[model samples]
Target: MIKECCNKIDNNKVLLSMAIKKKRYEALVQVYHSELYRFAYWLCHDPTIAEDLVQETFLRAWRSLESLQDDKAAKPWLLTILRRENARRFERKQFDYADVENNTLEDNKSVTLDDEMEQTVIHRQINKLSPEYREPLLLQVVMGCSGEEIADILELNKNTVMTRLYRARNQLKEALTDNHEPIKGALN
Candidate 1:
């Protein structure tokens, strides 16, 4: 009877460990996978590569899951992994830049020509922003990360992240205003 009890306890311990691992992985994927993918996509500007980077990031995270000591650190940890994965891509190979004609930026299906033109202009202006300014803004707007989270992810101070966000907004406003003034003048 004692032998059977010992076997049961051992089985229960094994099951509990497996369950913990499963929950951690599932929770990580459920919470951060999309955000990580978006961050990766903005970094590389390639959907396929972004998907691969997120996959690799999560794989690394799963391997080191126990090292994550704080719940709040998960997002930044995942983002750091993703950023490293992106950097490693450059180390592995020197990729040729894609030709502009081959780039397939999405076109919003709008019935009005003005709406389509407006979206195109906005997208172009965003693409024009330097990486320093662009990345923080992407983390805020796309991933919905707070300034502190962005700072942690980007390894910048919170003030720096705020400054980048400010500059990014100002640059976009100026670009749009400059573009629209000519159109308004023509109408008048």
Candidate 2:
């Protein structure tokens, strides 16, 4: 399968040499948009911003669709675009620190009682992470992108991505364990 997809890339240029850019673009969007939006949502913690970011990423992808190599790498290739667009957004306005770090989880305690309690627990915990850690976590666990792909997307060394992913999950585990601290209640 890997060999077949690589064969499609007549040359090692994702943006330029693909046989049908339009068809590829459509396939890319259809295949990865949901994953991208989820990733962006986790990054921005806002669905509206996530939607806008995904749109911007796709538009940029269309404009420079030729730079991508290895159709298999499309997911992370698109992610690199989204992350850059996210960084550029800060130059437009001075966002408050609070905008990014959502520290008010304590205020939404009842949210843990929902039907999809496990999902809510996980998202709530994920939301609690700083973006530095969250981005790697989302890329690996959510988007299912590989270490090489994430390293490319974040422009970090692959080892750095691996370490960060480890720390991210470790932090998540600690946070979730800390959250389960109703010792007296449980003891009763």
Candidate 3:
């Protein structure tokens, strides 16, 4: 009778453990999936690949869920998983070089906002920035991560993250000003 009782208790403990894991995984999906997907998109510049990358990241996260000790560390943990997944894509295979001129993705269309065209210009300039500057900027601006979080995600020091962010904003400001100067000169 005591053995049966112990078995029941063990089964109950297993069930409870599974329930807690499910709850945590569900919460993670709800909170970080979109943000992770956006970061993946920015990294790869392909919507389909970005979706796949997020799926793989979450899959790996689930497999290693026990390694995650703190709730606060989840964001950086997930982002690190995602960055690794993106890097692995390059390691897997080498694709033939495609002609850049014929690529449809190169086509940029201008969208006017109150005759300003500011949004389109900014989007283009952001895309123009080097990946070193753009990645930190996107993580902070889009994901709303702190410098420490960004540093953890990017595997850099906190000071490096801050410095990159400052440089990114200054570069954007200068590039935008330079772009508009020609129009201002034409107007004059």
Clashing residue pairs for model 2: 14-68, 15-65, 15-66, 15-67, 15-68, 16-66
**Which candidate comes out best when scored by lDDT?**
3
* Ranked candidates (lDDT, high to low): 3, 1, 2
Q: How good is model 3 by TM-score? A: 0.79
Model 1, range 117-170, lDDT digits (tens) per residue? 665566567778998987788778777889999999899999989999999988
lDDT of each: 0.80, 0.78, 0.81
Q: Which pairs, if any, clash in model 3?
A: none
Native RMSD of candidate 3 (Å): 5.2
Query: What local lDDT score does residue 68 receive in model 1, on the 0 to 100 scale?
Result: 91
Q: Model 1: how far is 106 from its true place, Å?
A: 6.6
Order of the predicted models by TM-score, top scorer first? 3, 1, 2
Q: Candidate 3, residues 64-133: lDDT per residue as tens digits?
A: 9989999989999999999899889989965443522211122256534533445446656777899899
Model 1 weakest lDDT span, ten residues long: 179-188
Index of the highest-TM-score prediction:
3
Compose the digit string of candidate 2's lDDT tens values, residues 1-188: 99877877745565564558888899999999988887787677677778999999999999988887789878878988998988988878666756563322223345444434555567777777888788888889778888888888889999999999888888888776688643221212
Error of 2 at 133 (Å): 1.9
